[model samples]
Target: MLEEFVSLGKWWLPNNPEVVVPGKLSFSPVSGAKLELIGSFYSSQFEEIGQVEGIELPSDFVSIEENFNLTSRVRIDFIKPEEIIILGLLDNNEEITLYRCSGRMKSFEFVKNRPNLLFNIACIFRKIHFQDEQNIKLKSISVQYSHLEQWIGKSGIQAVILEEENKIWISYQPPSNIHLTKIGSLDLNITFSPINVNPFDFYLGATYYKANIEQKTYLTIQNPGNQPLDECINLLISFRDLLSFAMTKPTSVISVTGKTDVIQTKPIEQANGSITLKEELRETQVIIMFGLWNSEKNSETKLSPNEMLFLFSDVENSLGEVFETWIKKRETYESVFDLLMTTMYTPSLYLHYGLINIIQALEAYHTSKYEGIYQDKKVYEKGLYKKFLEVLKDFPSESVDNENGISDEFRNALKGKLKSQTRFTLETRLKEILSEIFCLLPPNFIGSLEARGLFARKASETRNALTHHDKEKRKKAGKGQELVQLFHTLTVILQICLLRELNIPDDSIKILVERNRVYQKEWRPSSN
Candidate 1:
């Protein structure tokens, strides 16, 4: 792995591999790049001899000796290792080798014997490829959706079970029928590929040792049309977001590696300063998810942390369809998805913000899913606020732009209220969202909010109290643990709402939410 990461000081183009420059490649999880390259600062030595044309020197050596000194940045091509070649096609139909070579002239030296220029570049990439391929078409990519192993429960290494019947001893070995499972569309499939293990038996004079096949689930994504690498990465991230929401934990990306079609003759061997992948090389964070149960995919045995909101195995059959539907509405669900993820990712994050975020997410989801107005747009803008604006237009403009006047000050205040005027209040949206999602939850999961008449109004009070720091209003809001519970309850509601957005059915959503260990234990229900 280290060998794959370290590159010798040089790089070049595939079409023109001869012109090599002095540079080094660097990338990794902990050791991302602060790259550097050095080039000769002055070409005076060559110029003092003669000018070069098609050949190294002039046809007539006596033409002139032009002195080339260090004045500006020098442009040079570099060499890439011949074994692993990669190419990227641009939108303009021009093809180019992909390189993450980004750096600017750092310093030029005037020292004796050795004077050179330096370049400092940052080579870490997350959202886009370094070459700015815009939308790079990738054949396939490998990613580890964290905690997926525990969820899949399909590691072929099964325990050897022993049984005794009618005084006779017998052994019952768990079946080894594990195979790769593929899900999702033909153009894009999510494959749960199991690692291969060799089965062997070793025998000594009086004893024999049988080797069991060890298996761990591997995840790979395929894009038939060679979809953009960035999109594929987003798909990986989005699916992970779904997992994180389902598990109620911050599940970081485990590992990522991509490959172009091997038939393209550019099988990545050791990509130096580029995203080029070779031999399935990877840089990932320390292992965070571990196996809880030792069983294969076909086995009914599975385990999950009590904290998980829902187990992947429970909804997996429907997940391909769920993910397919969910991701298509990225733009529509971006706000709610981000807010939900933010709460999940940052567990110690301020609870006040979490409450506010979920509430905002509810508002955003409702706003997108259903369209309504507190007052019709024309009625409010033209009939309502317009009357105020008209009256203000006749009045003197804001005197000195201060708030104490009935001029532009009042006018601006009314305009500020315009956007919210037609939208549902935080309280109205909260009740509306809860009313719909509560029907999808287990019976009295959070008790009957309508009968108790406490959750929604108190939530609105708390949101406004914390947001505006309203001391008087704070009297009605929850304190400390109560506030945290409010936030937790709201987080649960948003999770269910998002599942509904994925077209998960009402009864299924109810069962899934009830199965949550935290939902069963931690949440406090409204009193009857």
Candidate 2:
């Protein structure tokens, strides 16, 4: 899925020496075809014997020859006058092209003297494999045969079924024991009674989430217990299933808890509203944990509002210049990064880079806060909306220029890229990629301008913090309680932003927001 070959003659011999009755004779090819030429080449011979009347026949017989060499063709004859025949081999030249005979005859037409030759010449064909297709493997083989005019009507192909309790299984076996694994497909059908198992008991566990505005996601997995699971097992979770609740009518808060080993997650907060993740699992689970964010969705970081206003103005003012430069190198990602770097200040970038503990707390607060609104919509919705607007109004302001010599043009360009977020802003383009930072929920989450703006501001801050650190700051950054606080705040913030999209519960959302606030109390408040 075979090509060129020559044909040979067929014959029937009756009691003659040159053509002995019911005997086999091997013939050699004179000129064409390739042969491995195993051992020596000579004419083939065979003898016929009558079977004892009551002896049962064996399915297969073993031949003890080293190998047979054929020059061109061979002939076989049977003493019995039975018209039935089964062709097992070509009995002629070997194949060189892409067409092959399946060792079965098309019609029962017997050429008076030529019994071997057929109307259509046979060739071999080989199939081509593609990169994407799965390589199919043979699992089992079977064959069967019956005498003509059996009681079950026709003698060919009968099904075998195995039954146990309410279950059934089917298979087929060939008449001979030649181990013909290449006989192709045989169907099997089975049904069985259900086996009971606990829904909470699992061999493995993991979680993930996404946000509506960001491209990144957060993910975590439990340490499988004593028994190790096969690595081939995959983690699969459908966004449609996870976000099904988000798309549905709002509900009350729900909560669950376990050892830290049972869950994997990033810090809750960052400059951006929150993060989200989606999971893939090898098996399905009915019960799962989801954390809702409680940080005020509309709540603003200290400098968030002013920062947004400044960047928004700077972007509008420099739009024409930025777009012009962007168009010149529109094909590259650097053009976009350069644009963002222009408008975002060191503090903004610093927060965006996610280095400071306060930045993480900010992210967590927003994530949990917004998530709580969805969880306890009736109680929190109006207040959260008010806070969100207040935060936006008081957002941070960027310095007109930096002494470090990072240009205003570059800052604006960078912010432009980050804000617009085309496919060009993928992690592949950025140096310290933030795939987990900006988690977008699968089904798409919506929020007020303040909620959205806070998320965007955090993203800018996280980026700045990551890229703008000097040697002195780097030296002072230690693996202490601050680092843990940063991660927790980051997770809480990201989780809230993600959960809002998921319509997570108020209790779960508040847990993360409160967690972040606890950590943020230790750090200096951001400059507005």
Candidate 3:
């Protein structure tokens, strides 16, 4: 569901500032937030005294509707007490633009009906812009994660309860940040902004915390000659996805903002008196958002640090080690990465596909990270396969390749089959990934050795079942709670496989697996 941000203000095309249209800008979840304009064209046509242009309002709307590029609708700028930049204002609805004439005007102006405007969506930038461009320049990017404090488990205060004495004690102290990690050439720091709390506020029921602090982790590119906005956003979004994977749920980004520029100066003191100066960078800040990831949530789910795949101690922790490999192989792994991340937001009925997505993600992961060919084609082609093809080329149409005896076309048909025949099957690749990952973690992290074998067979068959809708394989495929267990198993496997790919130590990931609450809960596949 979309939250609402409404502004009652005047809107005008940047080029036609004199013809400001009085209207309100509204955004909601329904119909994806369209901004409607009332009395737009007729009001503009009747500017000042009654002087109608050669063209009629209705004709202009019709002409613009036919030729959208010919109109002055590149961007409709709105201003409340604060300014709003509305980019890409396309007419959203197919319904006729309503129109009604004024009661009386005594001139040609009265004849033109006022038409209403509806614009689909536009990126709303509340700050100033020097000029409009598809991509923006950024000095640095700041990102805040939902429940970051809960994930980091760091704060400025603690509460202690003595149940026997029926006494409660609260203590406040200074908060500190965790160690910073470097992703690619960028430095990632999780900084906190603490707000001083008063004990008196709790008695008034206006506040809940003894102390409040917010996590605003920011990234700065190392030795960047010209900081690229896209690069920063990539790392931000990539890490956000990793966090989503960690939380076992999709975590909304509280805010993502770019600071385009900053300036620093020292205050000056004159002989007559001392002077203090304060200033802000012009058009320096702009907030960025993806419409689907609305920050406001009706319900919140918080987890202990140990419950997540990402384990952090308030004393010692680093996320960069795992993320380093992710960034380098991000493009290669993008397909699988996106597939796995989507399952977090999937509906329950479609969760059967969640199992399917993990299987696809695993297959994709292996394809990208491992050689899909089970054996080299040249090895077989130069010897047995070559001999077989030579025999087929001259066979007198009485040969056998299988149940269907060979024809002259058999040679060419065999050539086509050879391409895929040399490649590994989904079952083989599944086992290979399983075998390599097993040595990296505790023995049977998913289950006992036999159970692990059963998981691999069922997963591979299920992949075949879902792909071709094979009835027999589908009968053996995971379903009901079995599907749920398999989904959880594949998730843990992918998470650990990625950790190993990143060169994270075996011992480190094993410790995370043992500590993880969900992994421990769902590790025993036989329980299902």
Candidate 4:
């Protein structure tokens, strides 16, 4: 298996061969320019399947380089039994190659020196459909990183291909929190244009970031019963190890700060950085200073933790000590909850804002239908807030006693106690209000809102566990489970809500429902 696999590196081979051996195959840079030649020769067929690697001219699709570097041999056992599609970034243009190598039929050689070269050895493998002559078509290949070329063989890509496809479409402007993950299930057809294609595959491969992990998903063309036109397809959806790049190496520690209030810190280039103990880092805090705000007089205002809290507050405030006092007073969890409640009832708040807008628009349509006589602008809002208060009044903050068999009064008292100290912080209030408004939403709105509620609850739980929960509880919670659930739930809710709000009036909402159903059908307790 290993011998056949090694045959892939060699693009050229000696005349007809005999015995074949299995061994490891690897790629190393050759010269100073952005050129690399992949080399390999098979022992059995005595042929070279040489690959000329270098920048292809901007105008030309295929270019043969003058010189080649890097030499290796083919491993017979490792010869891919299926069709393979690989991508090479030549200059700025991307070149995709489909290789259909069967058995130990070929090989090639690479030159040893040169500096400017970059190659990602990962390839997408799909079953081959060979034509009579030389034309070949690959269907639904498993796409993966180059490192998986070892132990996993052709099957390593399966982890991504067979995994579930989760997508959501949001219709808000960017720079807005029109989140893709918070609404949880992503199978919905979202209205987003493509960014640069991840170099994972030349075609049928795309990716999006979720929880900071780069996941590559492929889209392919297939007939879905009578839908016309080519549809996007999936090959694999897997996470790549950040350390795969030879140019990237880890170091001890590095720190940087921001200059302006508007500057958000995102990685442009990652370099030598190491993980450290929380205590060590705590001693020397890395205060990333994104300018908070500025006064009219051009005086720069640095935001303290309390000032930052006020900045995110729902109510606008002045910049003086009065505003600071108000924020400090309002920073309690109860204050947040109250803001959440207000936001949930109002149409302009985070989660509730979208629902309110939709419901208000729908109510407007309903009123215009009956020409204002039947219009009850307050019905939706009324029902929503009533339910909000009801839930707030009834929701038990503490667990019900199973062994003690407590009385109803005891339970009620316990619930009230939980509520007493629990002031509505802005974040909590927003989540709760949205959850309630969504719940009380007309039948059309409930499904998506419920999903969003589930997502928010999960996120809240996870955040709590990370920030405040004891070690024992964290252990019981397991790793990343809550966060994943939160993301999934957010995806579903966002898609449902966005689809409904777009008011496309065709089958858009129906399409989202159908997609959700398709995903729901596959849900299992074990997977959760």
* lDDT (CA) per prediction: 0.54, 0.27, 0.58, 0.27
CA lDDT, candidate 2, residue 159: 42
Please list all clashing residue pairs in model 3, or write none if there are none.
none
Judged by whole-model lDDT over C-alpha atoms, candidate 4 comes out at 0.27
Name the top lDDT candidate.
Answer: 3
How would you encode candidate 2's per-residue C-alpha lDDT over 1-528 as one tens digit per residue?
A: 001233332222122224312212121111212212111111322223423354443446333222321111222232122111112123453211211112222222233322221212121111211111121111211111111011112122344445555543332222221110110122211111123434555545533243122111111123223111111011111111111112111111121111111122444554686765534322212111121221111112222221111121223233223323333332333322222222121223333333443343333333333221223443443565445545444544345334444444664565454333222221122111122322431211213334344434444444344556656444434334544444443333334444433333445444434433422422212235
Off by over 4 Å in 3: 1-3, 28-34, 39-122, 127-140, 159-174, 178-187, 196-229, 257-299, 314-317, 347-349, 381-415, 443-452, 517-528
Residues 153-172, candidate 3, lDDT per residue (tens digit)?
Answer: 66666679999999887765
Which 10 consecutive positions of candidate 3 have the poorest summed lDDT? 93-102
Off by over 4 Å in 4: 1-459, 466-489, 497-507, 514-528
Give the C-alpha miss distance for residue 453 in model 4, angstroms. 8.3
lDDT of 1 by residue, 289-352 (tens): 1111111121222335566766656665676676667676656788887777676666667778
How close is each model in CA RMSD to the real structure?
A: 11.5, 32.0, 10.2, 29.3
How much does candidate 2 score in TM-score?
Answer: 0.19
Q: List the residue pairs that clash in candidate 1.
A: 11-78, 11-79, 12-78, 12-79, 12-80, 21-78, 154-296, 154-297, 398-408
Q: Report the Cα lDDT for residue 170, model 2.
A: 33
